[model samples]
Target: MLEHELVFALREIALLGGILGDVELSSSELGGILGISQQTASRRILELEEAGYIQRKPGVKKQLIHVTESGSERIKAEKEKYERIFEMGSRMRFSGTVISGMGEGRYYISQPGYTLHFRSALGFEPYPGTFNMQLNGAELNKLNILRNREGYTIPEFSTGDRTFGSVRFFRAEISGEPCGVVLPLRGHHKGVLEVIAGENMRQKLNLRDGDEARLTVFLDR
Candidate 1:
């Protein structure tokens, strides 16, 4: 049979953690079934395992393989991830961080009137001050941006209201980096939630919404 490369590759790497007994698949065995070389199959297994989509366990005779909760997450996330890449391919819009000569590493994000600045980097550090630095792309590529797979859902303290499908990032104006993303409330909410980041962010990184803070979201299930 023609292999279902993507799905099979995913499953081959991570076994379905069944409700009953433990079952594990070795790369050599799965490789033969999928018509891929053992090394290729083994690499794939490692990749999936590293990505947190699957896990391996030891049994008396064989290793146990199973899909983790994160596996479902990857299945859902791949769609959004591909969509973002496709959008970038179609129209080259990107989000980059800008830096100012300030001693501290601060970035800004904003909506129409308000802005906010929180010192962070999901990890990477920003220069003292710069404008719109590109994300992890080639030097020739002017746009720097990162796409996160999972979005957050946070409930408001005052009301039972929840903000669904969230993404966070910083933007700077010193080098023309656009500010963070803007998205509306999803599903249960009657109307869209308009987020206004505070003004302190505006002064630090230099941000404006329509000009830089453009983003989209998928409603919560």
Candidate 2:
């Protein structure tokens, strides 16, 4: 495996470029971000472009750089490895404030395909509704950590009207109650986490909107 710092440098450059994936970076500026000399930064950029991790385009002013799909995959793989190492040594904790969802969870969780998978993988039938929570503070970072873990996959299946995308479930303990955290691979929610249990978690835990909840996720090695 390549060094993590190099992967991090690539990921940071991607983030700097935003959604358009076009970023203007000079050797000096890149050097400042990476804490290296301008010459070193220039060489690193050339090396990455040659390695097909990024593409560089000469511009009138600063050069335009875009991270390629290969670069994104490399960073993602490194993140997964990092999370595995983290989970091995520490108990992952997630903290968020209760929030409302778009009422889609009930419909989705109630689907026969999803229900069947939930029962089989999680060892319990999930409640129809999901307890949604908006991540706070560093919880968003922790959510990214959860994203890296390999979870039980609920495969996509077609219904009479439409098809539902696959969802991943990870084992978690919500306020000491065993539960499962669900993450849709393709969904609208970004910083929000949806949790499910055998019963309505709100009623079982006596939770309401604005209440803060913490979950200790047990990730498999």
Candidate 3:
């Protein structure tokens, strides 16, 4: 859905208890609340229902409306955007335990297509591998919030009949060492983060499996 529609119409419905439970209101009443005409309010409701953001059951006088799970997720995404806007210029810290990866990071990061862009955009040649981390619930939520913000983009490239997907990365520091938090545009794993640095982070930092590491991500206004 469009941003304005989500911000005004859907937000108004969610504020009217649609997110928690069913909300019964007629188009006229919704229009009065939104300061729009009854026809416009009804169209907005239809648009939301068609987009799978809401479920509506028509009644004689009012309609029983409930926000779907997808709708709740959209609202959460919008909330994250606002949070990032207000928290700009602040450093976001995430703590996680070092973990083992499936060796995919080694293969992908070693590719010349990705390595060239990583070096140019991140200002460092990656160590041909990644430092994997397993994040907790709170840290995962913070990561999700960062995902919604704009970050450095590595465009997709083709190499020898194979196509590599794009990536998004945010500049970060671990123990005051410059690094990046890499997020694959495709095949992303939940609750897991892959970090890239110029050198082997484990050796440089003397880290081991299950060691707690803190990353400080800089945010711009």
Compare the candidates by lDDT and give the number of the best one: 3
Q: List ranges where model 2 is wrong by over 4 Å.
A: 1-91
lDDT of 1 by residue, 119-147 (tens): 23212222222222323335224222223
Q: How do the predictions measure up, each by TM-score?
A: 0.35, 0.58, 0.57
**After TM-score superposition, what is the CA distance of residue 194 in candidate 2 from its true location, in Å?**
0.4
Model 2 per-residue lDDT tens digits across residues 1-221:
24565676787798797225779889899999989889988888887887788888987899999888888788778777678665653457777899888898899899998888878767888889999989977668877777767778778999999998888788778877878888888756579988888888888989899999888777762
Off by over 4 Å in 1: 1-8, 11-24, 33-35, 43-51, 58-63, 85-93, 101-221
List clash counts for every candidate, in order: 14, 0, 0
Clashing pairs in 2: none
> On residues 1-221, what C-alpha lDDT tens digit does candidate 3 reach at each position?
46576457778889999999899988898899889889988888998888888999976768999899998888888888688656555668788999988888999999897788778767878998899889997668887777777777788888887898888778788999988888887776578889989999999999999999988777542
Indicate the worst ten consecutive residues by lDDT in candidate 3.
84-93
Task: List the global CA lDDT of all models.
Answer: 0.41, 0.81, 0.83
Residue pairs in collision within model 3: none
